[model samples]
Each structure stands twice: as C-alpha cells, then as structure tokens.
Target: MSHTVTDDRQQQTHTPVALIGLAWTLVGVPLAYGLYNTVKAASALFSG
Candidate 1:
C-alpha cells in the first residue's frame, strides 16, 4: 500500500472564500451603498 502526506504551507495558497463573498456583495448590492458602509465602519473604527 502507498501513503501520501501534505505540507501545511501549501494549504495557504488557495484563495479565501470570504474575499470572494465580499466581492460578490460589492457587485450585487448598490455601489454607493456598499462603499458607504465599508468606509463608514472603517473610519469609525480607526478614527484616532
């Protein structure tokens, strides 16, 4: 019988699903609305 093993670093090369989801959200929803929420939330969080 033969056995195979994989390395951990190779697993990180795949694209993340969250980023794809975010892209879909940006396109499916209104441009202004999506940008507005992202900008608003980010600014609020980082307004030092």
Candidate 2:
C-alpha cells in the first residue's frame, strides 16, 4: 500500500473588505445609534 501526502500551504485568499464593512454597518451602526439615543435621553431626564 502506498500513501500520498498533499501540501495545502499555498492557498490564495482575498480579504472580504466589503463584506466586513457591510457587516459592521448593519450591526455596529444601529448599536451606536441606540447607545447615543439612550445616553441623550438619560442626560435630558437627569438635567431637566
């Protein structure tokens, strides 16, 4: 019986910059906006 070994250390890959950007926009933007609004509301309530 003979066994052959293959080398897979030469895979070429491209960075998904657009996908990562879209993901950040979809999740991060809403989170940031929610936090901003919450802080504004809290500050207004306390300052009033």
Candidate 3:
C-alpha cells in the first residue's frame, strides 16, 4: 500500500478592483438613495 500527500501553500484568491467597485455600486446606490429620500421626507415634517 502506498500513501500520497499533496501540499498547497501558495494558493491565493482575489477580487478585481473593478469588480469590487461594481459590487459597491450595486449595494450602495440604492442605500444612498433611500437615505436621501428619508432625510428629505424628515426635513419636510420639521420645516413646515
């Protein structure tokens, strides 16, 4: 019987900068819009 062993020491995974930026845009744009709308609505209540 023979046993074999394999080692993987230098494996690396990375997300490209463009992909990261796109991901942020996907998540942040709606969040920012919602925040803006909430603030706008809240201001109208206080200002009137």
Clashes of each: 0, 0, 0
CA lDDT of every candidate: 0.87, 0.95, 0.96
lDDT tens string, model 2, 1-48?
999999979989887999989998999999999999999999999995
Clashing pairs in 2: none
Higher-scoring candidate on TM-score, 2 or 3: 3
TM-score of each: 0.36, 0.61, 0.73
User: Which order, best to worst by TM-score?
Assistant: 3, 2, 1
Candidate 3 Cα outliers beyond 4 Å, as residue runs: 1-10
Q: What lDDT is obtained when candidate 2 is compared to the true structure?
A: 0.95
TM-score for predicted model 3 compared with the true structure: 0.73
What are the per-residue Cα lDDT tens digits for candidate 3 across 1-48?
A: 999987868878998999999999999999999999999999999996
Clashing pairs in 3: none
Q: Is 1 or 2 the stronger prediction by TM-score? A: 2
